[model samples]
Target: MATSRLLRTSAAFLAATALLISGCSSGSSSPDDEASPGLTTEAGAQRPAEEATLAPLPASTPAGLRSYYDQKLTWHACGNGFQCATMKAPLDYSRPEAGDIKLAVARRKATGPGSRLGSLLVNPGGPGGSAIDYLEQYAPQPASIRARYDMAAMDPRGVDHSQPIECLSNKQMDRYTETDQTPDSPAEVNKLTTAFRDFAKGCASRSGKLLSHVSTVEAARDMDMLRAVLGDKKLNFVAASYGTFLGATYAGLYPSRVGRMVLDGAMNPELDSRTTNIEQTAGFDTAFTAFAKDCIKRKNCPLGTKSTQDAGEQLSALFKKLDAHPAATGEDRKLTESLAGTGVIAALYDQRAWPLLRDYLAQAKAGNGRGLLAFSDSYYERSPNGSYSNQMYANPAVNCLDLPPAFTSPEQVRAALPSFRKASPVFGENFAWAALNCAYWPVKPTGTAHRIEAKGAAPILVVGTTRDPATPYIWAKALASQLSSATLLTYDGDGHTAYGRGSTCIDNTINAYLLDGTVPPKHKVCK
Candidate 1:
């Protein structure tokens, strides 16, 4: 049920107890802004063509895909020192000629005082999050790393600016997100399931042909194609959250082609959907415990300073109160139990947001839900004007396509509730119900839970944040153990990911690997 947004960038909003899944307006480089990769300046001025960086595809490349591999990209001078391009990927790899879909690509070339190493493709989690938005807005890479490698990103298929999947309308999404997750009545459960059904149907109706093709396997294939077009002999990547899964899949499929890859906030591909939800629930509980311990040390802590256990009871009580009598935000939207939970969950992604969560809880306790509602809005990526980016739509599309549902019926969910509650007393019920989302998916899963060894791949760095909420530290350990050449880098800290979040040790270790190919010893721990 947890949305594993890499480096814990922005928290993705999940509706109450259903496994669910950013918003950015769709963007493509304008025709007039297009330029050849090495021939145009960031200011759009003409320059002499430099030697192409594109590495030729292997001689064994299939004839059907040779044209795709041979395709040239014309970069555009996008704002803020980045170039953009559009690349075509087959809609269905099995039948290359069926059609092609356009993938939006963006890069900031290496600002060198050092010789350029190569392009380093980055993904900021969310099988649904937009890489372009991550590259442009988050830009977590340090200048030292940026100076040596072109930081590249592509919006994977069925994601933003890449034939994005569309689901509920803005208003529908609002209602859907606000729906009761901890259904106390059968009628409430039916309503919650109905919302999921409508969401799935909307995706099938609008996204249609693409829904069946947006699996992580296909996205990984797209990455390989991108690596070739960028002219890198091997794929150099830094992927977080769900991106870790994408990166591992690439290494598994094209082991010899992996280069200087880092998988942070790693996902255990071995776990089935049910186990992932349960473990993630426990992870969130761990994060909440950390938050409660910190809160108890502060004056006027909303949950009271009695004890962490007392704090959980108080928070649970608040949720129960909101469930019966919603709190009014300044805006038309009120803070219901689901949104209140989401708002709290959103802040847990990063320690930086703890103060905000404290303030929001204080406000909620005062019967003013404005702050919590705003946090929930941010989590949903709901614009003030009301339109949504395609992230929510694509999250389930990719998830359901990649793995089977956690629970196919309410009976199963009810049966599993006790175990979920044992995992997380506060958030377990919602997360358990959230896992039911894929059950209503239009397409049957194309993937199954399996370990990814990625044998023959270069040494891959696997990072784990001990208290990562969405992707637990245990998952990182599991992933590292599964990958043949992986070096486990443990951050005995809080937050969703380790690097680029003020940890000098984590940052230096990764920078050394990405810059000088210096792999750390096995099971290195950073505080």
Candidate 2:
């Protein structure tokens, strides 16, 4: 299975449960006028030179707030023994009273033998991945753990049933995901640039006004509302990958309401888009090197090289070959450069997937492209029947909303390529281009690359896996250092997220914290 599936499927499962709840009104300022300190508008327009002042929490939050929160929900029974609902929130937080936008929420009450600890909100990264789906599918907490908490998830604004931001039709998505992320020449580069522009245009046309407000900050605030509605005095959360950023933002904004939060596969909110993309590219390179090292020791390694560098060169050559002459899958699909690259990226997320990747590479080299294409399809979440979850579309929408575009244009990307490549010789160029997805985003960012000094927050735990591919390990370090009261938990492993991907030490440490409100000592490492 692809690593994306591991994360995306879990995310989708969480989103599935959090089915439509409510909407929030846009604040007084237009989306473009919102104070985003370190980001530029979609048109590359600079934000007005004014500092953003944090709005004070509502004075003496209404005594009937919980009742109001419940009354706003429209509930329905969903699959997997859960209830789903939709609720309204402002598209812009600045004008909470002006209008309302809908958000999807779901919950499965714990069937427990332990005292209820309150609602435990879960988010599985992607900035766009469905939190409801993760809760429904992958939340394998012990019945003892489940018995003590009501598990809940919400599809962030502009995702899934929460007034979804659709950028393209299914067919267009197929074409878009297949567009080469890595360009080998001027022609290929132009094709890549055009693909990105077309994607942005598609989003603008399809999503219209909705695209302007699907940001992390907005989602974080929505989470606070969810917390209020659930009648929990504090927010307890398990967030992976980009979800970590969301969770961290919540802690920053509502530290007094934090119960127990676990940020797995954390992203550094302090990094600029360029730095983030470059660092992630390097992370993939590190992961690939780990894979290559392991591959060389195995007798059946397809690349059949003694050195990791040689293995990368061979894989690059294979990609070049695939680009020039796409391989036909028996099912009438062809393996293009993008598909091959996707396959490679998918495998890098988990060490267990390495053997599968090797086998697929071997089969592809023999002119049977089915295996590799299957891996790519899995990463894209494209089922054989041609249906796809809204992950890719959601990923870009939320990601673009969270930070400034990595580059303003192809020229800027080209100028930065050498530095990116120097950071990760094998994967940098491709990731540098992939970061362009936000360059033409329909919504302007309302947040920026600033250290989230979550001052006044209770002790928050930040988790990191040394070999995590999607979120580099250093991010956990950076996030912990930035947060005023963060404690870092390290898991020396190879995977996307550490808590549940199977590390007894990691799981136990986190579970103990969640259960007792105890933070691991700073710089705690779990082997």
Error of 2 at 92 (Å): 2.7
lDDT of each: 0.81, 0.73
In model 1, the runs with Cα more than 4 Å from the true position are 1-8, 11-59
Candidate 2 lDDT trough over 10 residues, lowest sum: 26-35
**What is the TM-score of each predicted model, taking all chains together?**
0.90, 0.88
In candidate 2 the C-alpha lDDT for residue 502 amounts to 58
Q: Candidate 2, which segments miss by more than 4 Å at Cα?
A: 1-75
Count of residue pairs whose backbone atoms collide, per candidate: 10, 43
Model 2 per-residue lDDT tens digits across residues 120-227: 998878766777766787764656568888989999988777877776777777777778777778998788778777877888898887777888777887888888
| Number of the top-ranking candidate, with lDDT as the measure | 1
Which predicted model would earn the best TM-score? 1
User: How many Å off is the CA of 221 in candidate 1?
Assistant: 0.5
